[model samples]
Target: MPQKDYVKTARPKPKAKPRASNARRGNARPTQGANRPWLLIIITALLLGSFGWFLWYLKQQPANPQQPPAEVSKSKPVVDDLPVKPVAEPYQYIKELENKEVQVEVDTTEREPQGPFQMQCGSFRQAEQAEAMRAQIAFAGFASAVRRTEGTNGIWYRVVLGPYDSKRQATADRNRLQQQNINGCRIWNWT
Candidate 1:
């Protein structure tokens, strides 16, 4: 094993050339999409200018020869199919009663006035339905009242039983209503 000398060798690295400036590169390739912002601005300006020109052109053009306003018929088209029925005049007694003042008897001793508990049989949006329910209550031999209440949605017709003198009476009325197979009867307080 003889001694061996190790020599250090140096390697040279290649130098990178300077990059072209954006301005020079822009001039070299005029159609290159490098300046996208400028292209977008130019396109937008053209669009806005055309729109403004269109509006100005419209203003310069003479107002379309004012055509005569369309004639609107004052009368409605009527279809005369059924014969007209005559309306009955009011009873003569009503006019006589309107001018007369009559005396009435007081009977407050029978019992305290009815309480506020009322039995609501049904609520309906349609007048016909409410009327039908009222008729049904009449047929059932019970006096019912229709209350028209306006709410956010629309008018509501509520068919309700009397505000009985006590809760017991109201409960009894509800039971009677249920026996007749009439469901959805709910008690409500007037207060």
Candidate 2:
């Protein structure tokens, strides 16, 4: 068996050199002048300078023009402004009776005074409700007690504050209780 020889090769062609253009090879094709950021910068600076000058000018101006002072009266008015008539007193007899006392005989049929002031903090048909209100009043720092009484209407449980003799003292206590958010409290004169 004979071996065959595979040898004869073809010659390769040379690559052509790329020709440079006159514009690219430093032939002074006017280079687009260094991108003009300076113009934008100068414009911005001028705008800022103008804005500062405007603010300075505004600050230099006066807020208002000068004005003359207001004239004031030197003397009081001559005519009286009040009405000529005097007010009538409501209870002149009570004022007159302040110092003097006159005694006269009267029947003893009138009921005797039981207490000073009778305060009804709550009036409820339900005894439990009245009792609850009484407890609430006591918790809120007022001396409260529940009392049941029968009347023509029906039986009612009343939360009583005090049997104060003086109405003024009772009124003061009522006001204090009211300030503490206690509602439906009233002073009564029970004989």
Choose the strongest candidate by TM-score: 2
Off by over 4 Å in 2: 1-52, 55-115
lDDT of 2 by residue, 3-108 (tens): 7544533545578999988688979655455577788899999999999999999999777648655466668556678987768766788878898888998988
Clashing pairs in 1: none
Give all TM-scores, in the order shown.
Answer: 0.39, 0.42
Record all residue pairs in model 2 with backbone atoms less than 3 Å apart, i.e. clashing: 116-164, 116-165, 117-164
Per-residue lDDT of model 1, residues 1-191, tens digit only: 97654442244556899999768777665545665788889999999999999999999977765785656677966568998876975578888988999889988777765557888999999989999988987887899989999999999999999877678888887888778877788887777
lDDT of model 1 at position 138: 83
TM-score of 2: 0.42
Score each candidate by Cα lDDT: 0.83, 0.82
* Deviation in Å, model 2, residue 68 alpha carbon: 17
